[model samples]
Target: MDVREIPHTEATEATEATEATEATQATGAAHAAAADATAAALARVRGAARAGHPRALAWRTERLTALRALLTERQDDLAAALHSDLRKPRSEVDNAEVGFTLREIDHALRHLPGWLAPEPVAAAALGRLPPGAAATTRYEPLGTVLVIGPWNFPVQLLLVPVVGALAAGNTVVVKPSELAPATSALFASLLPAYLGADTVAVVEGGPEETAALLAERFDHVFYTGNGTVGRAVMRAAAAHLTPVTLELGGKCPVFVDRDVDLAAVAARLARAKFANAGQTCVAPDHVLTDPGTGRRLTAELARAVEERFGPDPAASEHYGRIVNEHHFDRLVALLDSGRVVLGGRHDRADRYLAPTVLANVAPDAPAMREEVFGPILPVVHVAGVDEAIALVNGGDRPLALYAFTGDEAARRRLADETRSGAVNFGLPFAHLGVPELPFGGVGESGFGAYHGHHSFAAFSHRRARLDVPIGAA
Candidate 1:
């Protein structure tokens, strides 16, 4: 039929109906394809697990060694992939992504034997057992597990957990974030070569593919991203009674006391907050301080930003662009929430946002309404430490709480009073580097924790074993 010859409304309706039908068909096909891919990946990993391929300490060590090789041998390839996806500088690629994962692997390799060892329970602790009886707790793998990565810090966050899963003697299905396409592709292409295609598989796609993957049962599902999607993953996991470890983000707060080195504080805060163009999950979301300290610190922060990025941050090689336009626009809108004391410039085509600082931001300001996962830093004036603590206590618990104060009393107060995943005194985000410390959030941020020994524990089932002499008792 010639649509031009037909009535305008009728022609338009007919075209719309046809377009809608085609769209529905395309969506269905995509889902079907995703299901097929997921099924194949799961089957491979499950087969490996069932065959007890991953149960051997030697097998686990070999896989870990291969992962280390991937990081070390392909350092340039990984750096280039990360730069393509995030515009991440080579130094950051080394320090945060490649080197970070390498360190995690090294730690796991060094400690895997001890982590897997069974612990004997004393007879007295067991309340007196029969002669020749023994009791112990053994760490066992949870079989095939799924790891879902976030776009930010794609390499480290995704592989670090996988290191733990493998160290604990389990096969893994890795889902690298589709947002970081280059890195994702790199993982899909390289992981098979290094870790083998059967046990550790990389599945790449957006939410649809993820949903398809979640439909199948897994021993464990570890997701790192926002809370909204974390809830959805939990719901899907519930279908099969599958366990999940959600590493989510929230508005991490920074509290500045009246007495302290404001310049030093500003310098540290600027480094921590503006790194990765402030897309960090543990970045300071807002600054809470007295009006006097807020004024002085704001000025110091301006100086720090200038010193770090020079006159124009957009031209600085070390400075990063927003991950995408959506985040850039969201960060741009936040500039209006308060007076822009520093760095309000942006270029949409380049996806560049200067390290922005907003002063006199009210409690109800738009920027304070949610997790500002960008280069925008908001300074909220408060009466004092007490008021700041009250304000923080009143809201949903943050992932991290930072206080730069020499006053031991104030520091203790913040540490004792605040309900957060972690408390940092004098600096922010440093705890993440310490592998001994458990990294995860409470309340809205996240539930499960993982890092170092904690990672091995997260993917392991600690079973209690008891052997008694039936005749001896």
Candidate 2:
């Protein structure tokens, strides 16, 4: 299908129509059937919050273990589905989505009990006035959580938080992105089969179904995607006062210091930057390298592009498509903003853009101003490290900030001065592998973290209790 940008009026109506259709088609049956199914599950969540039930928590954990097993057995199938939906290659999918989150589930399963254990807190002096008292902090599940996954990596985004909610002992209602319709349907079909339909349900639809879902009260909400839709999700979530974890995207910046290895940097950065066709939330949207070094980095990246994507990505199948032409055109427009140093070829039919590198670009150029999610790299030359930091911080807060430097001092300074969802010193995208590290964004990028303890925390609430037998006070 030739991709035409939907005008606001049409897009709004279409989204509404899709939502209405989804509610009428899927949600009606789901809501009617849920009276018995989710009620008891929801009661467990409530009891977990008020009375703190160990058995209920254990049951949720057991369900998680079973689901993790299902996720593990179907790794290849999940990877293939992701590939079919987003054109993600197997290796990248393994490294980025499948292996990463699967490993996360394994880690969570092994330690979830310890995490759920009530934390002991030192008692205040009031307790010691007559007798010493010990305090324990309780972690309880939010009754029901709404998780909205994005199209970029539908499975991981959806499953990752599901892991967290399960660990925290909450029932989840997942709304996968309609953009990746096949994966959405596959997930809807497979989840109910692998796990019970009552515990975890998938309501697949576009905006209106989402609006209705958002209209209802959820104890917590998790969303992953662009800032625009993120705002809408946040707005809807606000109506219910539902606490949300927004995992949105922004223009993640890469600062290449003058004192670094060009070839090694190219190898590491090229892999991270272009993986998944640069649609990654933390992918380097633009590069800020030192004077002359920017040009050198650009040239090196251009060479790396050829090394990575070959002379002609249009004819290559190893490289993935633009997912859709809307993104294809957005990337092509960035190409027009600057001098193309390396590759600039677009085949709309295939949704292919040659691993493109643009240079001599103004700082405010569309190539620099926007988040170039395709295989496009823009190089901006700066006078010094200060200028680079200024350039980086000048933009809205980004999800990820990458600084490449052998100078430990510069690296630390960059870390201190720059604020993002996460910061990496070297070896690009290394944070993705940190099992303990939380992945998320700040300001416009996103609001919450996932992958480790961060995920569990996002799905659960900390409720303080004054249980001094009602007399100690």
Candidate 3:
């Protein structure tokens, strides 16, 4: 079957309506303020960059060091803000957000000299050149960059790209998600003390502010959010010919083979899917397995959820609540889209939804149609690997894909056939921990990547240099 043959979901319509409603809530005066603030920030960054402040290796290193110190010193404050904004546990905040960011900083600092060094090109390719001729590709900073972060993983998503952009010697404007107001305020307030207010400015507001920011010119734009906002960012960047690296989410799928360890699969899936209330970009959106494997996996998954979040997940301190009422309702609507296998409890007042598993869901089910950025796990039974691949490829490419099997052929087939930002054999979302791996999406999931050298390259331009002999004759 053609990939486009798969039906789209109502979740897209729901998300667009939500985005429109939220974007319009901000007033005209707010838009004016956002535009003025963005303009002023852009000017300051451009001025600083022109003055040769951020270009120095020492300056870049110092700024990265200061950012690390900021995360370390303000860990408590950051965690508290995250809790207030997303109901994320302090431990989750530290491990998933702060720790990951610190690692990125450390990785960049260690390898930045080599990354910035000019790569020598073989002069042999240009036989017409004089004997003294030399060629090299130098990675240079993109002057002023904009980092538009998402509400989920607000701290990490916002500042990780800043780590790369700053390391590449560019001035930055960070626009944190308005959905996470507390974290946004914390970033705007605290970033100045660490990275210097003038060099890295944080603009905190809704879509109007983001739209205003995008209207201005920038050397590079890095955005992490839904496809709707991502398209808007791309359009705005297109007008100015600004390069963009979008990190959008999609319906990441997991294919399970009969030979897998059901218990291990359950533990890994439960940890990844339910973490941060399943608001992760790379989390497994759905599962495809044969009937026997599906039944066994579902049983194991129920036990895994009970083990992690306990019978009353709402009371479990480890589990998080839904980000807000809108998302909570979205998730609630999905529960009805499939047959519940385990844990369907919810509380709208607290914005809580238990780690849920829905079995025997149809391909056209609302929950299966879109990126289910929630704790709802829909297990759709498939005949085998071919069916699973067809079902997955039928939709837009996802940010990540998982196949659980010890068979080498199965792994190879999945790797060869599917398109995703990353593919893994045993677990999900752990690919993000490796700084060496580039993280982002493909197709509808997202475009471009950033992490390690990828981040440096993404934020920097490769300028070709040549030493042309004056006596060319």
Per-residue C-alpha lDDT of model 2 across residues 209-307, encoded as one tens digit per residue: 677677767889898888888888889888888898888778888888888889788877888877877787888888887668877787677677778
Task: Give per-residue CA lDDT, model 3, range 1-473, as digits (tens).
Answer: 44345345655666678788878776556667767876776778789988888888999999999999999999999999999998899889888899989999999999999988889997577788877788899988889899999999998999889999999999899999999999999998888778886689888888767887899889999999989988999999999999999999999899999998899999999999999999998889999999899999999998999899888888888999889999999999999888898888899999998899998899999997788999999999999999999998899998999989888988898999989889988989888988888998889988999888888889998999998788875
lDDT of candidates 1 onward, in order: 0.90, 0.77, 0.90
Q: Candidate 3, which ten residues in sequence have the lowest lDDT sum?
A: 1-10
lDDT of 1 at 342: 84
Cα misplacement distance, residue 91 of candidate 3 (Å): 1.5
Clashes of 2: 2
Q: lDDT score, residue 101, model 2? A: 70
Candidate 1: tens digits of C-alpha lDDT, residues 1-473: 79889899999999999999999999999878867876887788899999987888999999999999999999999889888888987888899888888888999999888888889997687667767888999889999999999998999999999999999889999999999999999999899889988869888888877888899889999999999999999999999999999999999999888888999999999999988889889999999998899889988998998898888888888888789988888889888999998888899999999898899899999998899999999999998889999989988898999988888888888988889999998889998889899999998999899989999999999999998887875
Q: List the residue pairs that clash in candidate 1.
A: none
Error of 2 at 103 (Å): 0.7
Pick the winner on lDDT between candidates 1 and 2: 1
In model 2, the runs with Cα more than 4 Å from the true position are 1-57, 124-129, 314-317, 466-473
